[model samples]
Target: MINDKSFIHYLKEAEQDFSGWDFSYVTDTGRMAASLLSWSYGSMAKKLITEATSLLDMGTGGGELLAKLQPFPHSVFATEGYKPNFPISKKRLHPLGVTVVEVDEDNLLPFTNGQFDLIINKHEAYSAQEVRRVISENGIFLTQQVGGADCAEINEALGIPLNQEYLHWQLDFAKKELEDNGFRVVFAKEETPVQRFYDVGALVYYLKAIPWQIPDFEMGDYMEQLYGIHRKIESKGYFDVTQERFIIKAEPI
Candidate 1:
């Protein structure tokens, strides 16, 4: 049901300017595109999703997946680190009896131990230790990450290369860190790469829109760089960009 056209509209609406302390542009659009491009969490969690009393939709944005999961026999609590989207999510989930928690990336979540039966995150910055700290012993933690090792391919296609060394090693380190944190890994699958679109203008728009990704980099001057890449890629009708993602499910021990 998700297509490129709908994604464009979602991007446009999500980029709309908002004023407040809860402003996180990248978390908003990034999560949406990640969800639409692939439902890695839903597919991975399908087998494990059973009747639970409560579930936490970590990094919930646009409320799309959370909304879809609302019909289950559980109370859904949505958490978003992006401040601006928190109010928007609250408005949407209030009528549906979902609680919205505004999370701060620098601080631990304001929840007691063993608060949720299921914790899910798609494109979130949480590490395995963080998930293990708050989840109940029997609870499950599901994540769909940006596949740290293979991210360069997509960056090259986007004309924005990340200046990181040993990216793949970092992902492996993360896996080890999670296992060290008392989580037993259940499933770990990497999704096949898929194509995504961003016209020259959209690409430039996104650079400015998601400052968190390239905070120190000056995007204005990069317009030319992006345009050049866009022209070269678009000349062939479409950019052959692809993103590799990882789906992981673990349970606290």
Candidate 2:
């Protein structure tokens, strides 16, 4: 039984609006943290942005990360496919002189050929052909993807069935896809880092925020498992899970 008053407090905190792609709520609480990979996505992206005159940030989410890359290029553009995030992205990016566009994940982008000299994507799906269509000749494409098997341990912990969709979303598969789309793969790396949750409430908040991790997640339905996991946390200090991540840099051939 979850008898502690803190348990209810954390559960309520986890149920708030996760409108943007931000995770500061859980992260700031020091309830959860992940080990870093060998490479840094922000550093690499900053270097590329410094050199490009025109740039595009796909799936810019609330433009939180993009906003930090200030002193931007002459032309900076961002796209958000999730409708709820569109207005958020615009509000955060528009004042920075970044054009925030609403895009359909499955459709072609609205720009003309060779529109941007650099394109950056982080944890967003893209149609390779459409990316090729919009990028200028010799343009650079940098993307950091969340591997399909990311956080599979979470599913295992909760006795949830694993999905097959992301089984092949590793670095090699991403590189091959880009090459097949006429992009010359320049750099690629993959890492499976360990993440630790200090409390059951953190795990609950995470699953609730990123629903895809546990598509059918519900406190009522998984109460037994949650209680079991809570007991484990009380004994072990934390719950550990692995997260898959990969980064690829390419250029149109």
Candidate 3:
């Protein structure tokens, strides 16, 4: 172990309290950034909300994105699977006339059949059958999912095996599942954009922020590899990785 002060400082700087699916600390400071996709989920959701009477936001983390698209429909609801985020979602969305529910299992939604006409999900898992049951006949189910291959390069960098469980989670796989669940797909697209980290600290922070990226990750376990990445960043200026994203808009047939 190097046990150097500079390295310790980087780890200390990276050890930040991340909450509500927010990564502004590193992103806003130019330490790390991801290339923009051709489509914007917010713009699409905003337009959908204007047309629908009832809306459901699945996994409304901290209600960050949902709150931005204000002047919501008559019945607005949000569901969060994470326990910690349930309170945060309620506190932020409740006052705005949004009913936030805590859902432990995505397959079993605690809602009546045909309860919503517009359902929007970002980076959240859902059962197509359950969605079809809860959404009205004319309902729209729009989702933006992170592919199983999302940032796998980071795993390779750290000498960690790719998460096998999620490795096959791609656009085609998702689209087929929705279709099988009695949905007619309208719009669908996929993208693998570039994501760059300018420093080792930023990478550390990002890995910490998203624990699933490296399951049970600890600074001590990857010290040497991190130091190597630190040297590479020092020489090459940035560590680049591919980010997988896909969008699907479907309606019940």
Candidate 4:
């Protein structure tokens, strides 16, 4: 078990603001590492954007990634469902002529039918029907999703029950869903990359940043498990977990 002083220090640092979708603070510290998928989501999206007259980026957190793909199409739009990220996305994307729109989680996209020729979604939730409605007949939809069974090893290490919500969220299910909604599956791939945390602080920060990983993740409630994992990390140099991810490209039929 880590000492009281070290434990407190880690907890305090992990509790800092996690605004936007940025994870550089923990990742750059050399305490966390993960494997990459064979395909590149950014490169594919950028290439498609260059070929399209209009484009939409869904769930653009703080518009960080979108801003990087400069020299955008004449009509560039982005939607963010999370309230806190709306202003941040606007501040970053507006100067680049990208319109940042705030959207309700339950409502349809606030755009006319067949508005965009290309739509890109990275780690975001989307409605298949809504995507079909807004996209042009020949439009392309490219998305990279965090699969439901991601980080099962973390739950195992913590001695917590696995969350059943994402048990069937595989590549096959995603492809079938899009096909059912009038999309022809073009490219689909899934990978379970191993992620390693070299320190307890990195693990805590990751879980805090992604609350859905463990809904009731209270430090007090899981102190024993945390310490056990900490001991393992101290001995083995890292704690490893598999992360589920998938990417798909579909065109409306």
Candidate 5:
């Protein structure tokens, strides 16, 4: 269990950080991204909810999907590994009767095996084996991952190449890992489509959210590049940057 009140403080921090952002031009694009992500969630769990009474959403960012599913009868429990994200996500969904817990990324999940009829990890950290461990037999494992060529436009706009090789590995090796672990694959496909946005600043914010972007790229450099890109954004009115993403669905054996 998490202290929902204490979590409010973290949400405040995130809101403050996000407040400085300029989202004027890209509101539509932002909404599209949210809609697409949320749609992926609905696609994964729709069938399960018709059959089962419980679900677990791993890395339920800002509890967006959980809030969307509130009207459904399933008992939804969520876990977020990042401490900062946990509190903010809790605040977002708690009012809607969603309960989110903090979980250690490397350890066993708090719930026992076969506890949930549906287990989902949308844009969550990867611990393929851990996923195998916690899910109930025949339970669904749904995911939408950062695709191999995600955010290629940012790289192009800034005249730099970001590592997209991992996406290649995700398809090649990750699938085999799941199969060897006794899970049967259901749906797997590459969705290499660009999510359009109007505001260059909002695009910058999403780029900053990436983990590798935090460690390797200097914030000053990124801001400088973003500032330079803003001129183009102003000229064109909006940029339709294509990002590659993968959608995977599986069930435990």
Candidate 6:
């Protein structure tokens, strides 16, 4: 039974609080581990910033990743759609001279056309046309996206179907979308990396944090599946899942 003493004990451990696009509670503590990717977006961004006079960071969650990728260009901006992250990003980025904007739709950017020389997005949804419209002719658009198959193993283990709408979102689809929208892809790569969770609670906490992972996720509804996974983890040491990831670097055609 999931209500057993041991199950409850680990569930309590998984309830540890986290905030601001940060997952250090699990990641830093060794409760969860993800394999590394071949490329580093931060390193690439750092190099590009030196030559860029204007920059935009799309969906800058809590401004944490943006903050890390700084010494920014003269005109730097970040957009976040999530309301709870607005104040958090503002507090962290304002002092750094970034203009944090609240955006409602991925297709409707508030900035004027040809406004930015460098635009970067990490694990964020974006519209190809909107991005092409905003970037200068000589500008660069670099993004790392989570593929439709991201963490599908979790859904499979829980007997849930993968989200159909995003099932075809991968490097090929994104590259074609950009090309059709007047951008030439300069670099693109995709990889499936392994992510291992040491306990069931870590997975619960993760799914809770990322609602889209299991929309309408309720602990009560998933108790049996959770217990099954818990038992598996206890027997196997960890539950492993392959996550889909891809990166694209493009320029206006």
lDDT of each: 0.61, 0.88, 0.92, 0.89, 0.63, 0.92
TM-score of each: 0.74, 0.95, 0.97, 0.95, 0.75, 0.97
The number of clashing residue pairs in each candidate reads 2, 0, 0, 0, 3, 0
Give me the displacement of residue 88 in model 4, in angstroms: 1.4
Clashes of 6: 0
Model 6's alpha-carbon lDDT is: 0.92
Best of the two (1, 5) by lDDT = 5
Candidate 2 yields a Cα-based lDDT of 0.88
Q: Write the per-residue lDDT of candidate 1 for residues 1-253, one digit (tens) a residue.
A: 3244543353355445543223344344432132244455676555445656667777887565666664644566878887767777888776787888888861387777788888888777775666777788898888777755443543564466565653553445656767899988877766646534334434434444445445454444454455555566457643444456777777877
What's every prediction's RMSD, in angstroms? 7.2, 1.5, 1.0, 1.6, 8.8, 1.0
lDDT string, candidate 4, 1-253, tens digits? 5476766677767776777788788898888999888999999998999899999999999898999987899999999988888999999999999999899862489999999999999998899899999999989999999888899989988888777877888889999999999999999999989999988888998888787889878887888888888878778988999999999999999
| Model 5: lowest-lDDT 10 consecutive positions | 13-22
TM-score of 5: 0.75
Root mean square deviation (Cα) for candidate 4: 1.6
Name the lDDT of candidate 4: 0.89
What local lDDT score does residue 116 receive in model 3, on the 0 to 100 scale?
97
Task: Please give the TM-score that candidate 6 achieves against the real structure.
Answer: 0.97
Runs off by more than 4 Å, candidate 2? 1-6
1-253 in candidate 3: lDDT tens per residue?
A: 6876766778889989877878899999999999999999999999999999999999999898999999899999999988778888899999999999999899999999999999999999999999999999989999999999899889998999988999889999999999999999999999999999998889999998787999998988999999988878878989999999999999999
**Candidate 5 C-alpha error for residue 153, in Å:** 2.8
Ten-residue stretch with the least lDDT total in model 4: 1-10
What TM-score number comes out for model 1?
A: 0.74
The parts of candidate 1 lying over 4 Å away from their true place are 1-39, 46-50, 72-74, 149-171, 216-219
Worst 10 residues of 1 by lDDT: 26-35
Q: Which scores better on lDDT, 5 or 6?
A: 6
Tell me the tens digit of each residue's lDDT in model 6 across 1-253: 5457777787777776656698888888898999999999889888988789999999998999899887888999999999888999999999999999999999999999999999999999999999999999999999999999899989998999999999999999999999999999999999999999998888988987898989999887888888989999999999999999999999998
lDDT of 5 by residue, 1-253 (tens): 2334423332232232432123333354452242243246575566666666667888886675666664644477888877767777888867766678888854577877677777777666667777777777867888777665666677777667767546464555667878887788888876556566555545655555555533354334554465556556567866676665666788887
Model 4 Cα shift for residue 139 (angstroms): 0.9
lDDT score for residue 15 of model 5: 31
